[model samples]
Target: MQLAANKGFATEKVLNLHEISHSLEFYANGRLVRNDDGRQRKFQGVSEVIEFVKRNGGERVLVVLPLDRVSEMNVDSIEPTFIADNGALALYAVRVR
Candidate 1:
Protein backbone atom coordinates (compact mmCIF):
# COMPACT_ATOMS: atom_id res chain seq x y z
CA MET A 1 0.00 0.00 0.00
CA GLN A 2 2.75 2.45 0.94
CA LEU A 3 4.83 1.57 -2.11
CA ALA A 4 1.96 2.14 -4.52
CA ALA A 5 0.99 5.24 -2.63
CA ASN A 6 4.54 6.55 -2.86
CA LYS A 7 4.44 5.81 -6.59
CA GLY A 8 1.30 7.97 -6.87
CA PHE A 9 -1.39 5.25 -7.15
CA ALA A 10 -4.55 6.39 -5.46
CA THR A 11 -6.11 4.35 -2.69
CA GLU A 12 -9.45 2.84 -3.66
CA LYS A 13 -11.65 1.63 -0.85
CA VAL A 14 -13.43 -1.55 -1.93
CA LEU A 15 -16.58 -2.32 0.02
CA ASN A 16 -18.57 -5.05 -1.70
CA LEU A 17 -19.43 -8.74 -1.77
CA HIS A 18 -15.87 -9.98 -1.84
CA GLU A 19 -14.72 -7.47 0.78
CA ILE A 20 -17.43 -8.55 3.17
CA SER A 21 -16.64 -12.23 2.76
CA HIS A 22 -12.85 -11.82 2.45
CA SER A 23 -10.87 -8.75 3.37
CA LEU A 24 -8.50 -7.80 0.54
CA GLU A 25 -7.22 -4.29 -0.07
CA PHE A 26 -6.94 -3.28 -3.73
CA TYR A 27 -5.44 -0.25 -5.52
CA ALA A 28 -5.49 0.34 -9.28
CA ASN A 29 -5.84 2.41 -12.40
CA GLY A 30 -5.83 1.60 -16.15
CA ARG A 31 -4.24 -1.89 -16.48
CA LEU A 32 -2.71 -2.55 -13.06
CA VAL A 33 -3.92 -3.11 -9.52
CA ARG A 34 -2.07 -3.83 -6.28
CA ASN A 35 -3.11 -5.85 -3.25
CA ASP A 36 -2.26 -4.14 0.01
CA ASP A 37 -2.90 -6.73 2.69
CA GLY A 38 -1.55 -10.21 2.07
CA ARG A 39 -0.87 -11.48 5.59
CA GLN A 40 -4.00 -13.11 7.05
CA ARG A 41 -5.75 -14.61 3.97
CA LYS A 42 -3.25 -15.43 1.26
CA PHE A 43 -4.49 -15.57 -2.37
CA GLN A 44 -8.13 -16.53 -1.77
CA GLY A 45 -9.22 -12.99 -0.98
CA VAL A 46 -7.10 -11.36 -3.66
CA SER A 47 -8.05 -13.88 -6.36
CA GLU A 48 -11.74 -13.56 -5.56
CA VAL A 49 -11.57 -9.77 -5.90
CA ILE A 50 -9.56 -10.04 -9.11
CA GLU A 51 -12.12 -12.39 -10.66
CA PHE A 52 -14.96 -10.12 -9.66
CA VAL A 53 -13.25 -7.02 -11.04
CA LYS A 54 -12.29 -8.78 -14.27
CA ARG A 55 -15.85 -9.90 -14.87
CA ASN A 56 -16.94 -6.31 -14.37
CA GLY A 57 -14.58 -5.03 -17.16
CA GLY A 58 -11.09 -5.04 -15.63
CA GLU A 59 -7.88 -6.09 -17.37
CA ARG A 60 -4.20 -6.64 -16.60
CA VAL A 61 -4.60 -6.70 -12.86
CA LEU A 62 -1.48 -6.94 -10.73
CA VAL A 63 -1.83 -8.36 -7.24
CA VAL A 64 1.04 -7.65 -4.87
CA LEU A 65 1.48 -10.29 -2.19
CA PRO A 66 4.04 -11.29 0.40
CA LEU A 67 7.02 -13.22 -0.88
CA ASP A 68 6.47 -16.14 1.51
CA ARG A 69 2.98 -16.72 0.10
CA VAL A 70 4.31 -17.61 -3.31
CA SER A 71 4.39 -21.34 -2.55
CA GLU A 72 1.41 -21.35 -0.20
CA MET A 73 -1.26 -19.91 -2.49
CA ASN A 74 -2.98 -21.92 -5.23
CA VAL A 75 -1.76 -20.19 -8.38
CA ASP A 76 -2.76 -23.00 -10.78
CA SER A 77 -6.43 -22.02 -10.63
CA ILE A 78 -5.96 -18.25 -10.93
CA GLU A 79 -3.21 -18.73 -13.51
CA PRO A 80 -1.41 -15.39 -13.41
CA THR A 81 0.17 -14.33 -16.70
CA PHE A 82 3.42 -13.41 -15.00
CA ILE A 83 5.04 -13.43 -11.56
CA ALA A 84 7.75 -11.02 -10.46
CA ASP A 85 9.88 -11.27 -7.36
CA ASN A 86 10.71 -8.07 -5.54
CA GLY A 87 12.63 -9.01 -2.37
CA ALA A 88 9.93 -9.13 0.30
CA LEU A 89 7.06 -8.75 -2.19
CA ALA A 90 5.75 -10.91 -5.02
CA LEU A 91 3.60 -9.55 -7.81
CA TYR A 92 1.17 -11.64 -9.85
CA ALA A 93 -0.15 -10.01 -12.98
CA VAL A 94 -3.41 -11.27 -14.50
CA ARG A 95 -3.80 -10.18 -18.09
CA VAL A 96 -7.22 -10.96 -19.49
CA ARG A 97 -7.21 -12.23 -23.03
Candidate 2:
Protein backbone atom coordinates (compact mmCIF):
# COMPACT_ATOMS: atom_id res chain seq x y z
CA MET A 1 0.00 0.00 0.00
CA GLN A 2 2.97 2.29 0.63
CA LEU A 3 4.10 1.84 -2.93
CA ALA A 4 0.65 2.73 -4.20
CA ALA A 5 0.62 5.77 -1.94
CA ASN A 6 4.03 6.84 -3.24
CA LYS A 7 2.71 6.52 -6.78
CA GLY A 8 -0.34 8.64 -5.89
CA PHE A 9 -2.87 5.87 -6.32
CA ALA A 10 -5.90 6.24 -4.10
CA THR A 11 -6.44 3.46 -1.55
CA GLU A 12 -10.09 3.21 -2.48
CA LYS A 13 -9.21 2.64 -6.12
CA VAL A 14 -6.81 -0.24 -5.54
CA LEU A 15 -8.60 -3.30 -6.82
CA ASN A 16 -7.77 -6.69 -5.40
CA LEU A 17 -8.13 -9.28 -8.13
CA HIS A 18 -8.66 -12.07 -5.63
CA GLU A 19 -11.27 -10.27 -3.59
CA ILE A 20 -14.63 -12.07 -3.45
CA SER A 21 -16.66 -9.82 -1.20
CA HIS A 22 -19.17 -7.27 -2.49
CA SER A 23 -18.46 -4.91 0.37
CA LEU A 24 -15.90 -4.43 3.15
CA GLU A 25 -16.71 -3.18 6.62
CA PHE A 26 -14.01 -0.71 7.51
CA TYR A 27 -15.46 0.76 10.69
CA ALA A 28 -18.57 0.62 12.84
CA ASN A 29 -20.00 2.78 15.61
CA GLY A 30 -23.20 1.48 17.17
CA ARG A 31 -25.58 1.36 14.17
CA LEU A 32 -23.32 3.36 11.90
CA VAL A 33 -20.96 1.37 9.75
CA ARG A 34 -18.62 2.28 6.90
CA ASN A 35 -18.06 -0.02 3.97
CA ASP A 36 -16.16 0.29 0.75
CA ASP A 37 -17.75 -1.49 -2.17
CA GLY A 38 -15.66 -4.48 -3.07
CA ARG A 39 -14.90 -6.12 -6.40
CA GLN A 40 -17.87 -8.29 -7.17
CA ARG A 41 -16.47 -10.29 -10.07
CA LYS A 42 -14.16 -13.25 -9.75
CA PHE A 43 -11.32 -12.94 -12.21
CA GLN A 44 -10.16 -16.08 -13.99
CA GLY A 45 -6.59 -14.95 -14.40
CA VAL A 46 -4.03 -12.24 -13.81
CA SER A 47 -4.14 -10.88 -17.34
CA GLU A 48 -7.89 -10.44 -17.12
CA VAL A 49 -7.56 -8.61 -13.81
CA ILE A 50 -4.89 -6.30 -15.22
CA GLU A 51 -7.06 -5.41 -18.19
CA PHE A 52 -10.00 -4.81 -15.92
CA VAL A 53 -8.00 -2.45 -13.72
CA LYS A 54 -6.47 -0.69 -16.70
CA ARG A 55 -9.88 -0.08 -18.19
CA ASN A 56 -10.99 1.34 -14.86
CA GLY A 57 -8.15 3.93 -14.69
CA GLY A 58 -5.52 1.90 -12.83
CA GLU A 59 -1.86 2.53 -13.64
CA ARG A 60 -0.12 0.05 -11.35
CA VAL A 61 -0.64 -3.27 -9.57
CA LEU A 62 0.85 -4.85 -6.47
CA VAL A 63 0.87 -8.63 -6.62
CA VAL A 64 1.08 -10.62 -3.39
CA LEU A 65 0.49 -14.08 -4.78
CA PRO A 66 3.07 -16.78 -5.15
CA LEU A 67 5.61 -16.41 -7.94
CA ASP A 68 4.58 -19.68 -9.53
CA ARG A 69 1.01 -18.49 -9.92
CA VAL A 70 2.10 -15.24 -11.47
CA SER A 71 4.63 -17.02 -13.71
CA GLU A 72 1.83 -19.09 -15.20
CA MET A 73 -0.01 -15.93 -16.26
CA ASN A 74 0.67 -13.57 -19.14
CA VAL A 75 2.33 -10.51 -17.64
CA ASP A 76 4.47 -9.40 -20.57
CA SER A 77 2.95 -5.96 -20.66
CA ILE A 78 3.43 -5.23 -16.96
CA GLU A 79 6.80 -3.98 -15.81
CA PRO A 80 8.23 -5.13 -12.48
CA THR A 81 9.15 -2.10 -10.42
CA PHE A 82 9.88 -3.73 -7.06
CA ILE A 83 10.23 -7.25 -5.66
CA ALA A 84 10.21 -8.27 -2.02
CA ASP A 85 13.21 -10.01 -0.44
CA ASN A 86 11.23 -13.20 0.12
CA GLY A 87 9.97 -13.13 -3.49
CA ALA A 88 6.39 -13.51 -2.38
CA LEU A 89 5.37 -9.95 -3.27
CA ALA A 90 5.90 -7.84 -6.37
CA LEU A 91 4.81 -4.44 -7.61
CA TYR A 92 4.25 -3.78 -11.29
CA ALA A 93 3.70 -0.66 -13.28
CA VAL A 94 1.06 -1.26 -15.91
CA ARG A 95 1.93 -0.11 -19.38
CA VAL A 96 -0.68 2.03 -21.01
CA ARG A 97 -1.17 1.94 -24.74
Q: Model 2: per-residue lDDT, tens digit, 1-97?
A: 4444467533433223343322222311121111346223444566775676577676554434344455633556565444332354333333434
Question: Global CA lDDT of candidate 2, please?
Answer: 0.42
Question: What would the per-residue lDDT of candidate 1 be over residues 1-97, giving only the tens digit for each residue?
Answer: 3453454333332222111222233333223323466322233565575665567676444455566655534545555533444576554544333
Overall lDDT per candidate, in order of appearance: 0.44, 0.42
Candidate 2 local Cα displacement, residue 75, angstroms: 3.1
Best by lDDT: 1
Clashes of 1: 0
**True-structure RMSD, every candidate:** 8.2, 7.0
Candidate 2: list runs displaced more than 4 Å: 3-12, 17-42, 72-74, 85-93
Which pairs in model 1 have colliding backbones?
Answer: none
By TM-score, the best candidate is 2
